[model samples]
Structure formats: C-alpha cells, structure tokens
Target: MDPPEQLALREVFTAACRAQRAEVLATAVRRFASAILTNLAARPVADLLADYFKPVALYAICELVGIPATQRAVVAESAETMAASMDGVLDPERRAAAIGSRTALSRVVDSCLRSSDGSGVLGHVARNHRRLDVPRSVLVHSFRLLLSPGYMSVATAAANAFVALRAHNLPLTCLSRDTGVDELLRYCGPVQALGRLCRSDFDFRGTPVRKGELVLALLGAANRDPERFPGADDIRLDRRPNPHLAFGWGTHSCLGTSTARLVLSAAFGRLADQFPAAELVSEPRYAVRAVVRAPEALPVRLTRGSEGAIR
Candidate 1:
C-alpha cells in the first residue's frame, strides 16, 4: 500500500466515488436529504441522529455505491456494528463480530459488483477498471473504506454540528454558506485523529519518530490551535482564511470531503428553510466511541416555518 500502488488505488476509488461529477452527487444528496427531512418533520419529537442524519447519510452512500434497496438495511446494520466495534477493540467478542461484519460487507460489495450493469460507481469501477492492476480484495476494501466513514463520519458531523449550533444560539442559516460549514466542520468534525505510518525517520518538534512506526496526528487539537485559528475556543461561522484539518491534510485526506459538504449543506438548508423553529427536545447524549465524537441520541422537536415543508 505504498507509492504507485496506493496512488493507483486512490485513483480507482476517486472514480468510483464519482468525484468528478459534483452536480450529480449534489442532486442525489438533495433528493435523499429532502426525503429524510420530510419524515423528520412528521414527528413532533424525533431522535435526529437516528431519524434524520443517519438515514440521510446511509441513503446517500448506498445510492453512491449502488447497493440495492432491499439490501441496504443489512448493509447499514453491519456497517454500524463495524464502526461501534472500534470502541471495544480490546474485547475479543467485539473484535470477532467486527471481523464477521467486515467480511459480510465485502461479500455484499462483491455481489453488487458482479451483478452490476455499469450504472453506478461500483459498477463503473468493476466494469471499466480491470486494467489498473489493483487487486479485487483491495478494491472491495476501498469500498468498505468509503462506506464506513462516508456514513458514520458524515452523520456524526452533521449531528454534532446541530448540537454545537444550538448550544451557541446560532441559527442554522449559518450552514447555508461554505465558510460557515467549514467552520462547523473544523469545530465539530467527528474524526478526532489521523493515524499514519511513518515512511522515514523524522523529527517532529524535537521528538524523533522512527521509520515504520505509527504516528497519530491529533486533528482535533490541531484544528483548535490558537496560533493557527484566532479565538480557537469559540465557534466562528464567519472565520476566514480557515485552513482546517478536519478532513486531514495532504494526499491522504478523506475522499468523500465534497460529498460530506454537499450532504450537510442540503440537509441543514432544507431544515432551516422548512423548519426554522426547530428546537432541541433534550440535551443530546454523546456517543462514547474511540475515534468519532457524535451523539448517541439527539432529541429534537420541529416546527414548520412559513415556507412550509420541502416538496
């Protein structure tokens, strides 16, 4: 997973993610977000994490990966199990369950690729990328890599952003702009750290890191560094020149960054316009996970705005 091989694999994944088709992805996101929000609006009090954000994130990624509708429930359940297992990495039972879930997800991806008629991202990659020399196993793993974070991270970030904004009494309107969204991403992004294997011995601010060792860049801390971001402790929706590492930095950044942004914007924009009086029913209970910081449950009560529901 080094150099040309890694680069080749990334290229294939990038293509499979429809990275070049921003408009297509945006449309798909809006469609899914609208549907999820419609359901959310029906409930007087709903768990936003489970009812709104998670459903939107799950549907968007499933559509992108070309997973059949009938199979999405199983796929989403397995993916959630796999993500939650990270918190119990030391427990043998959880570890075994994670392995089983991963295997099951890979099999699903294999089936989708085999039966694909070259319609969606998975189909396109499976049908057209045979000359890349990437292993089938690697490709499947790449899809899992895309699926897991694409769902968990995006959903978590959206949920976290809601809580953050509400706590600050900031209107959801802030999310309408790219700068506001980026600031929320910097402040409430779910990824707490980025782990990288050192390629060569190097000095990190007087600390020596050996080659072949694991180095964790603390992204959460870096995003809040006062030197890099003025008034780093506060949420600044108007923060400019904000070069946040919420999505990591350099070549290894999250592949679904743009997709995440589109999903968030569509989701909050629809919410703000349709349900401007939305309020929290109760304080959100945070999930106690290893890497991702998100709510276990976000209870919210929605009231329709003058504009009415999205149709």
Candidate 2:
C-alpha cells in the first residue's frame, strides 16, 4: 500500500485491463468461438466442454498472457490441479499439487520475462514494472493472478450459462442484449468463493473477525441472496442494475472484467446463433472441485436449424 505499489496498480490497469483493446479481445473471442463451434459441429455427441470450452478458455487466456504454445498444456494441467486446493481443503495430495503448480508456473513466468518481446500483457507488464515501481516478485505472482482463474473461471462461467439456458428452456434470443449475459453470469458464475486475510479486527453482522484470520466469502451464496436480488434463485434475463459479485468488488475486482464480458458475450451469442436449439442430452455433472463450479462433462444435443443430433 505504498505510493509506488499504488502507482504500479494503476499502470497495470492501464496497460492490460482496459476495455478498448477491442481488436485483441475480438481475436480471442473469434479463436475460441470458432474452435467450440467446429468441435461441436464435428462430434456433436462428445463432451461439449472437454474438447471445446476448456481448451478455448486455456488458449484465450494464454493468448492474452503470452503464454507460449510449448508451455500451455503443463500450465493448464497444473492450474487445474491447483484449484482443488482452493476448496479450503488442504489435504496432502491437494497441497502437493498446488505447490507443484505454483513452482512450475513461477519458473515459466520467469522464463517468459527473460524472453520478453515487449508484446502481450506479460511483456508489457514486464517491461514497465520498473517504471511502475512494482517489484519483480509481485510481477511474477501476477502470472498466477492472471492465468489461473482467467482460464478456469471464464470456461466454467460460459459452460454454466449454457447449462442454465438449456435447463430453463431459454431460447437464444435471450442473449440479444447485454442484460442477458449479465443475468446469466449472476445466476451461474464459476467461482464458488473468494478468500481474504483479515488485516484488522472487524464486526460482521455482530460477529467479530479478528486480525490474522482467514475469511472465505461465499460469492455463490451472496449472488443467490434473495434480499439483494428478488427471485435470486431464478434467471432473470432482463434484470438491470444487477450488481452481482461474480467478479470481486472494489480494488480487488477482476482486472479482466471487460475482456471476460466480451469473450462470454461472443461465446454465448455464437451458441445462440449457430445452435439455436441446443439441448442437454443428460444431466450436466459438475466437477467435484471446491473453488470453481464447472461441469465435469456437458453432454448436449445440438440442433442445426431443424436436424438434431443425439449424445
């Protein structure tokens, strides 16, 4: 919280988090959207998620972060295994996985820094860190900050939205407006929780939270709270003023909010347009991971105009 660190934060936002990077955002969207549609069109009966959405998420995020093609699979695998540790269950296996992933990613990020071509987010952040007065260590950690959830959350959120759409028999016309995408994110966002370390003693609804304590905020529960959102349990496609915390609030809010919105809008919009009559072939089983609420497998039957394919 020094002046230099604050400046660094502002610089990072300016460099990589702006909404006007429409060309890059559009490319990421098109790459992933086309991949998803191609995979679906070819093998309609397969796990719509496994072969398409997950890879799309990984590739899009990596493209943004400038993660190399050679390192992507390892990074993706480690990041996913690391998510299991976020359930607040630090069993030995989970802890081991998380440690291994952190170490591997840190090394990869360091290598990326060494070869910085002054392109992409990672390169920009790397080149400007000294000017921003940000520590190299912090810049390295930012890799995980950007990549881990960037892949997991976007993929999960998109998949969850698809499931909700099919389950409720909501048609593709719903996504014609931005409100539609916002409501879908609120109803079925990927993140289950957000964690923070208490910096000082505080009262929460008359309960005392001591400093040095770890607090896990249940974002899913908050988004579903009926008091804040009437009919919170239901998907209200046109719900305006939806201040849902699918992304975190305040200074710690998601830096990629603009990019995520564009990616998702493009994703669901394409789904609605191309496969207007996509249907769930079976119950969508969620992954057992604690932090990210994504489908383990999504078996959906896609209808091209009038012809339907089975799972």
Candidate 3:
C-alpha cells in the first residue's frame, strides 16, 4: 500500500485499539486466562498450545474484531487451516487449501461489516468506510490481515515464551513485569522474519539492492545480535534498554501491537500469579512455518502452587 492509504487505514485500526478498548480487552483476557488455567490444572496433562493459548488468542481476536460468538468456532477452524498452510508453502495442495480458507474468512468479514452495529474494529471501519480514501476491498483485506496476526501470531508467541521459560527454568513471575515481557518478546517472538519490497535502490555495507527487489529482514537473528544486545543468547527477563524488532519497526510495523501486548501481558501475568508450578510434560512439537515459527502443541502439567491452588 502507498503511504497515504496505509496511513489512513492505520488510523482506523489505531482508533479501534486505543487505550480504552485495550483495557477492556485486557480485562477479558485475564478472566479467560484464569478460567483456562484452572481447567487445565484439573487435568493430568494438557496441550497448552491447543487448549489454553490458542483459545485465549482466538477469543481475544474474535472479540476485538466483532466476530459473533456463533461464528467463532468456524473462524478458528479456518484460521488454523490458514496457519497450517504457511508451513506447506511449497505444496500445491496446502496452498489451495489456504486460498479456500482465506476466502471463507473474507466472507465472514464481509458479513460482519454488513451487520456492523458500531462495535469492534469491523464496525469502526464499516461506519467510516465511505469516508476513507482506500477501497472497500482493501479495508476487508486489512481486516483479514488484522485477524491472522492477532490470532496465530499471539498464540505462537505465548507458546514460544513457555518453551523459553522451561528451557531456562525461569519463574513464570518473570512475565509479570513490563521489562520482562519486553525481553520475552525479544527472545521468543514467533515472527521469524519480515518481508518487504525495496522501493528504491540502496546499499547496505557494500551490498546493493535495486528497486522492486525483495528484501527480508531477519528479525530472529537481529534480536540475538551479540553486538547490539550483550549476552543476547541468554534470556534476561529484566534486560533494560532492550530495543528489539520482534515487532517490525517503522511505518509497516504490526498493526495489532497494542492488542498483542495486552493479551500476552494479561495471560502470562495471570498464569504467573495463579499457576506458578506449571511444567512442560514433554518437548513441544513445532509447526512447520518459516515466517511465524511456533509449536504446534505444548504438553504441560499444571501443578498446584502455594499461592494459587489448583481446584
């Protein structure tokens, strides 16, 4: 998208995800996270990614985008299908399935817009669609963009965080602080890279890039750059002055940054406070995706803690 159109659409998303809406989403996330953890605590073992994190993310995004409760299950299924297709980028069958799923999702977005009653992000866009400079199709695509990352990316990030926590034997409480959350985002962010098209020719330390060439920013590598982040290999929960690009930088940054942060912070903070004794039951099975790397399943055994008893 051109700068003007991008800026205009971004304004709509920004308004939808402002402070007031974020607080409401945060409260909902905390409640949902607590309930999920409590239910998992009752089970001998649970797939944290499938049962807990995925559901939490699905609920948050659906609510944020005004997906009706009746349609959430269908949306979640399509979203997962789309996420699975990412790993099979080379396979024609998967690509076809992804296209089908995307179309289904788009239809849902259209439905929401048609029935919009001034609620959620879809409502905001629908009400102002006529006034916006961008085409209606573009707005619909943008809504799809919002849903994909808000759901899949957030779930994957949480799973990655748990993997890191288990590997390092870090206390769940580490996620309670903003600094710790930032460090977690740096170390375990699910987005492996950001892809862009070069608009103009440029040189990077002698390497030249021409206009229209594809450029990939390796976010995972940059986050671990030893020169930029001292002891970058280690997960320091309280790392200060950590300016990481886990979320892409500049104008094309992730549109749901605020929403993702609120969900992660609330969900993890609730886990830390209520289920400190949670442990991974086995090695996580990762999904096959190059762009948004995350575990397909995270088996966990939640034990009762002194502070938060398992009921």
For model 1, residues 93-179, the per-residue Cα lDDT tens digits are: 766788888988998888887874844678878776777887789888888887888788888888989888878878887788888
Candidate 2 matches the true fold with a TM-score of 0.90
Q: What do the candidate models score in CA lDDT, each in turn?
A: 0.80, 0.75, 0.80
* Candidate 2 per-residue C-alpha lDDT over 86-107 given as tens digits, one digit per residue, 9 for 90 to 100: 7646466787668888888888
Q: Rank the candidates by lDDT, best first.
A: 3, 1, 2
Which candidate wins on TM-score?
3
Candidate 3 per-residue C-alpha lDDT over 152-182 given as tens digits, one digit per residue, 9 for 90 to 100: 8888888999889778777777766778777
Clashes counted in candidate 1 amount to 0
Q: What TM-score would every model get versus the actual structure?
A: 0.91, 0.90, 0.93
- After superposition, the stretches of candidate 2 with alpha carbons farther than 4 Å from their true spots are 1-7, 88-90, 306-311
